[model samples]
Structures are given as structure tokens and as C-alpha cells.
Target: MERRPRARLELSDRAWQVLAQAGGNVAVLHRHLTAAGGQVPSLASLYRVVHRDLEAGRTLPDRAVVRRDREERHTRQAMADLALASPRQGDVAEAVLRLPRSSSTAASAVPVGESGAVAGVGLPAGAQLVRTPSVRAVAEPVGQAMAAEGAVCVFGDPGRGKTVAVRMALSVVPAVWKVTWVPVPVRPSVAGMRRAVFDALALPGRFPHTSALADAAVAGALGEARVLVIDEAQRLPVPCLEYLQSLCDHPGTRITLVLCGAGTERALARLPQLASRIAAWQEVPRLAAAQVAPVVTGFHPLWRTVPAEDLAWIDQSCAHGTFRTWAALTTHLQNALLTTADTSLDRALLARLCQRVAPPL
Candidate 1:
């Protein structure tokens, strides 16, 4: 005898209502249905039913669509509330909302050879951003951390371009994810760190007085998916790190924490609890010897005019493959070219400028 094909599972009106109330979260809907104690399908089967309904033009929205709509609504409401609370802050909020939401938009936002700088390091107006291997190395782990909603630690020696590279990678993140860059204050306390997070998020109204109330506010705001970048994280004390861990550990919050600094690895090592949760540890090393000529030449037109051998000599003598040093050298070269028509870029002139910028070597 031929067996009958199993019937397709269907969602009831009540189930649909639960799904809607859950903001299209299928897992939540499944749990609700299971708790109601009826003939409930497996999670996988429920997902198939939902997918079928979606393709059939059902009114229920997909989880992601629903989430985006809700976030947009919340952002608008927050702006209005902030405007009423403080006009200056409201203006700031408006400016933040205008930030580029997609990778293409972000790339266009910062044009090459413009006055814009990365991570507060001054770049020469004639300098161009080159996508080096170090940048690609950073982008991979940063992207992974964002996708997994986990933690990542980006560490390197000073001037190795860790912050700049991380910023570059984050600039390309999809528009759906909210990215918050928290500037770690010098010698920060937990309270100070909490306030920094609150300010970074641009949460409306004044910060709360009590720690409990402040954390509640922060946790509530973090209910939506967000990537929190704590730059110069090495400055954070154990208490502050624990505080951040608490925020990430909140059951309702979906947070991807990125700790970036020169000694971030060592800092995280001090806190095994937080370190254990890191999904990736990316280190930005100095530019390789082979990359010196190409990277610096692409970085500025002045370098392009310099011979390959001279560029290598300069790297070996002073720049030592550091991006910050290259930026400084480029600025000096650009100035020398513009200010003095007679001045030519030679090893002698390069040596003088290198002495001004590079550490003793």
C-alpha cells in the first residue's frame, strides 16, 4: 500500500497573532505556541509554513523587515524626544542620522585625497587610502564579529593602523546594523565608561544618576542589534571591562563588542571572562618591506614621483612601514613642495622630515 504524503502544517489565527506580537520572531512564536499546549509543529516545520505564507503575500512581515521598520520608528521618536529635551542634542542626533548607512554611501562620504582623517590621525590632503593586506586582514575578522554578534579584539603597536583599519572595515557594514564607536576616556572608571556608552549611543535625555537606572536605560536601548566599538580599550580598568561585559551579557541585548587599542590584547588577557568570549583576535602589523613602495606611492602623489629605491631606503631608514609615519612624511613632503618651489624631494630633505616624525631609530 502506498503511504499518504504528510500534510503541510498551517498556522492558526492565534498563532499568527502571537507571531505578530513577537515582532515576527519565529523562535518566540514557536515557544508561545508550544506553551499553549496544542498540536504544534517542529521549529523547522513552522519556519517552512511561515516562508510559504510570506511567499503567498500574507500580511505578516519577515522578522528582518519588521525589525528595520521598528528601529526606524524608534529612531524618529527618539529624535523628537531629544529635540524636546534639548535642542543642541537634537541637532546632534539629526546629524548622526545623516551618517552613511551603507558601505557604498560610506565609501563616497570620504573621498580620497580629501582633508578627512581616520581615527583622528591627520592625513595629508593629497594622500589617498590604499587597501593594503593589513586592511584586508582586519576586515575579515571584523566582518566575522559583526555577523556572529560576538566580540573581536584588534590590537597592534602604536601607529600600526589598527584603529584606522577597524574603522574602514566597519564603514562597510550593512545598513541594518547599528555601529556605536565609544571613545574610551583616559583612566576611566566604570561610571565614566557607562556615561561614555550612553553618550555614544546618543540616547535621549540626561544620563541617569544611579548605576542601576543607567544600566537599565543602556540595556533597553541595546535591545536592538548593535556593534559597540570601544577604541583605546586598553585604558579601561577591570571594573569598566566587567561593566561592558555586563551590557553584552544582558539577555535582551544583541551586542557585538569590538575592543581596539595598541595593547588591547594584553588588556583583554587580564580579564579572562571577557577574553574568552572574543570570536576573533586581529593584529595590524607594520607594512611589509615589499608593500612600502606601492602603498606610500598610492598614499600620496609626492611618493609617486619618488623612485622605488628611494622609497625603500626611506622605509628602512625612518618610516619603518608605519602608516602614521607615512602620513606625517607625506604632509611634510606636500608642504615642502608647495611652500618652496626650489625645494626638491631628495634623500637629504626626506631624512630631515623623517627625523621630525619618526621615533629614534
Candidate 2:
């Protein structure tokens, strides 16, 4: 007996456009297509089509290429602005430091924690919040943005405490302001985003079925003085970002939007309309060398006992001034201390723990 012909998978023009808009992100494209209400192929099938039909044949640009182009454009714009404002002395050094560093290089040089928990990573029991320079630097802008009902974008490499800084800043806002932290859904879409906002605001009614009704409900709730903090905002696709812009632009809504994420600046770059309206863009850098000892010691009691030289070695060897790494290292050190009767914190012990957390060199 003859077997039936295997079905073919093809992406329509609209789907292709969605793929392009998604910057060749197969997962996001698949989500958008599925959400748009159609019989979309399985993710694996879509990946096969994207790689074999689109990428290999050059019908679509590679994601890396798209990312590089965006980065170059941003770098040029930054350089121009820096040139205009920068003083003559130390201009080269300042420019080098200010330019966006690639994640790989930053990771090689430096280092998910829960959103807004503590120090971007969840605070271990008995851990104290240390006001590092990055945290202090973010607080003012965050406060100003909340007070003015403006937008602020807090972005940096992951695990550097960007989320915690924003949370700390929001903590001080006067009791009158209703602060809502909207958790960004994985592979988010406009609809998912709307639901997140509705749930986050604790609106009285169920989420509306249609876009118009949902927007109406969201805008009505946002009419109150509210600070909407969206953490992990870098996960937002273009459509979702546009949806946020719509809420912020709504006349009835009195909302201060704070977007926090790793690579959030690059995400915002995809939508200049939203980026242009932001009042402040705060970047949380890694803990500086000088701050490592003081900040890490303050972050946990365990670190207080570690000698300064050893702490410095830990930073250089693994932690690289990254709070998340430090948090992980601290946990490991704590476990070692508790489990082993004669455990000592030293370079040899740190090397073994660092191996667990640090990526292979």
C-alpha cells in the first residue's frame, strides 16, 4: 500500500513579516503566529523551516547581524553625544568606559535572581542590603521618575542588582503613590502583557476579552497615581513594547513606567518612539574594585570575616564584582562553613567554589 504524502510547512507573508519583526527569534515568531489564531506548525518544524529555508538561503537576516547593526547605530549615536558633551581631558578613557560592552566580554571580565527580591538575587537569611554606588546612583533617577510621572529605563548585565536598585528606590516613594511591579511573562505577547498589567494593578473585574476593553480597563485603573515597574523588560517583543507605549500615552492614565532588565537598552532601541519619551536611562554597572570589599562585606556577615586580600582575589578570580556571583559564592561559603567543621575561607577553597559558579574560561 502507498503511504500518504507528508504535509509541507510554509510560513505566510504575514508570518514572515512577524519573523522579521522578531529579529529572527523563532520562539517569539512562533508565539506571535500562534497567538494570532492560526494553525501554526510546531516549534521544531518552524525552527527547521527558519534555518533551512530562511537563514541558510539568506531570505532572512541572521539575528547576530541584526543585533550588530543595532549596536553599531547605538554606538555611533553615543559617541556623537559624548563628543559634544565630554571635556577634553580623559575623553578617550571616558568614551571607552561608556560604550556598551558586549555581554561575553563583560562576563569574561565580571558575572537570575528573583525580581526585586534583594540585590537582584534573593537575599539569604541575615543578609543586609548594601547601598553600593550603582544602587545609590539608580535611586535618585528612579525617585525623580516616580515623582514626575515619567519613564525611566534601568538596564545592565544580569545579576548586577538593577532590579533591586529600582525596588529600593521605589520603596521610598510617598505612601500616596501606588507602586505595581509587573512580572514580564516568558515569550510575552501584547495579550499576555495586558493580563499582567491587569493582574498587577489588582483591577476589580476580570481581564477583558478584547483589546479595546482591556485597554479601557487598564487605563481606568492607571488613572490613579501609579508607578508601573516592569522587571525583565528586555524579554518584551516589539508589539508588547508598543502596547506599553499606548498605556503610557493614554490621556487618562497617570503612570510612571519603570523598565528594568538586562539588555533593556537594546530592547528599547527597537522602538525609538518609546525610547524617546523616557525621562531617564540609568545603567547599573558592576561593583567597582574599590566597592567589592565594603559592599560584599555589608551584603553578608560571612564576607565580613574574609580578609580584604582574599575578597579581592575572589572578585578577580570569579565574582568579578557581580552581585549575583557574590551571592552564589556567599551561599557556597556558608554551606562549607556549616557542613565542614574545620572549613576555612581561603584562595584554595574559593577556587573550588568559583569553579562551580564561573563559566569555563
Candidate 3:
């Protein structure tokens, strides 16, 4: 048997800086540090640091050790504008103190339930109507983006409810708003995306079929109430994403942009111009172990018939408590109950379904 190499307990400042420069790529940093001297940490230690940061709050896999100066200047402009909104700080301070603080701290913040409880409120919902703290988390930024008519990106794993959360958030927008939702095309390309935009906003045929004119037409159609939501935005061509960024900068017709998909951060990174201008970057989280009962029961009437223990099993074993997973499993079970005479969601039924959805070793 071979022994695994252990990670160093402490790393030198030079090693840490190298790791940061490498964008938290431990292997690269390790090679560099080892070539320089023996001060570098092993991959295990790197994983430890990454996992700890992830558990704490940071969602990105490789978060470069960032400093304030690295932040884009325009991103802070919004904060300044918000601060300038208050003519008198004294009045705003007094009012802000009276408003809720404990809950609105961060998107990941959850309410404290009784001792040993999940520390969050449960909104009994069903199907597309499923409501929870996670939805509220995604909604806040969307609402702010709507107000600022800026840009936002919502990203998460598959079936994590990114689409549903965006829909629910947009539902609260005023009726006067002109919204266009364009789904990603099968074979993504800049030209295809331009066509999609033109069709969605109903741009006139007389307009020249050039990217510049398309941007002009889209911008002209935009107002404070106009918003374009691109779903599965990760599949978008890099050029198109950057082109949309140009649209964001169009003189007076700044429209709100909501880009929702998995791996959205990576896609945005490819277009630094667009990524820097993003007003909000929200990640929709999956359901937790404790939320199995509340979310499932409220999600659909079928869940009411399922046993609580079975619900927990499905959450942990099958669906993993994600919004789409739960909804899909529910559908399969509902179909089983109706078409077949199963009529029951026993552990055996759930196990079989789990195997169908996600095979276990």
C-alpha cells in the first residue's frame, strides 16, 4: 500500500501569494512553490481552505484572494448612488435601525427556528409556486436590478430552481414593464442570439441586419421598465454576451438584464466587460435536509400523502432537496400512483425511483 502525501499545516506568505495569483489553483501553486523552495502546501491543505470558505459563505470553487482595489469602479457607483439617495444620513440611520436587520443581512442568512431546528421559515407552496428562503434570497437582487435597470446573473446546479426563482421574482414587477424572455438556442452563436433578440423585441425588418443596429434598436426599445431575461445563459456565445454588455452601456436606454443558468460565473468571466458591470450575482441554493418536509408538502398535494420519513429519504437519496429534483420525483411518483396501482410511496418505491433518477453504486 502507498501512503498519501500529507498537506503542510502552515504555508509561507510567498506560497499564499503565489496561490492567490494562480486563482487558487493549488496544483499550479504547489509546482511553482516547490520549484522555488519547499514552502508550498499540499493539495489536501488547499482543499481544506477552499471547503472552509465554501461552508462559510463563498460559492465559487476557486475564489482568488481578492482585495478592495481589484473591484470594478462602476460596481461601487451603485453603492454611492444608494448612499446619495439619503439626503440626510441621520434620518436614514434612525429609520434603518427600526427596520429588520437580523434577517436581511445576507442572501444565505436563515432565520433561527427553535433549538435544533433548520433556522428558516417554510412557505407552503406547490409546483412552480414553491416558495422558501432561497427564493427570497434570489428575489432581492432581481428586484434591485429591476429598480436600477442594470444587470444580474443567477446561477446554480441543474434543477436548483434558477428559472423558477427568476420567474417568481419577476412576478412582482409592475404591469407596465415590457419584459422579453429569450431561451438559449440549441446551437449558440452571435448571429442566432441577435436574431433571437430582434424577434423578442419585435425589431423592424427595415433595420439593418448588423450587430450595431441591433443594439441600437434594442436600446431604443428599453426604458426603466424594460427588461430582457436570457435563460440558460451559460450556453450563450461569448461574443453575444459581450455584445449584450455593450447594450448595457447604450446611452439612455439602459435595460435590466437577468441572465440565468448553470456555470454562469464562468460564462461571465469570459466577458469581463459584462461581468464587471453586473449589479448583482446571486446563487440559488438547493434545499437542505430539514426543508424536505415543508418544501415538499407545500410543493404539491401529492407530497402530503408521502410519509415524512420517506420524504427525508427522497430528499437525501434521490432528489437531494433541489427544487427541480423534488418536482421531478414528485411527478414520477404521481404518475406511478395514477397509471400503475402503486398508490404508495414506500421506501422500496422511492429506492427504485431514486435509481431511475440517480443511480447509486
TM-scores of all predicted structures = 0.71, 0.67, 0.62
Clashes of 2: 0
C-alpha lDDT of residue 354 in model 3: 75
* Superior candidate under lDDT, 2 versus 3: 2
Stretches of model 3 off by over 4 angstroms after superposition: 1-128, 204-207, 359-361
Task: Output the lDDT of residue 25, model 1.
Answer: 78
Writing each residue's lDDT as its tens digit, candidate 1 over 87-114 gives 1243222212211222221112234422
lDDT of 3 by residue, 18-96 (tens): 6665676778876886688745567777678756765777543234325322332343443334322231243223322
List where candidate 2 sits over 4 angstroms from the true fold: 1-121
Per-residue lDDT value at 129 in model 3:
52
- State which candidate, 1 or 3, has the greater TM-score: 1
- Model 1 segments more than 4 A misplaced: 1-110, 113-121
C-alpha root-mean-square deviation, each candidate: 12.1, 22.2, 21.4
Report the C-alpha lDDT of model 2 over 231-333, residue by residue, as the tens digit.
9999999999999999999999988899999999999999999999899999998888877876776667677677889899889878887898998888888
Model 1 lDDT, residue 353, Cα: 88
Ranking by lDDT: 1, 2, 3
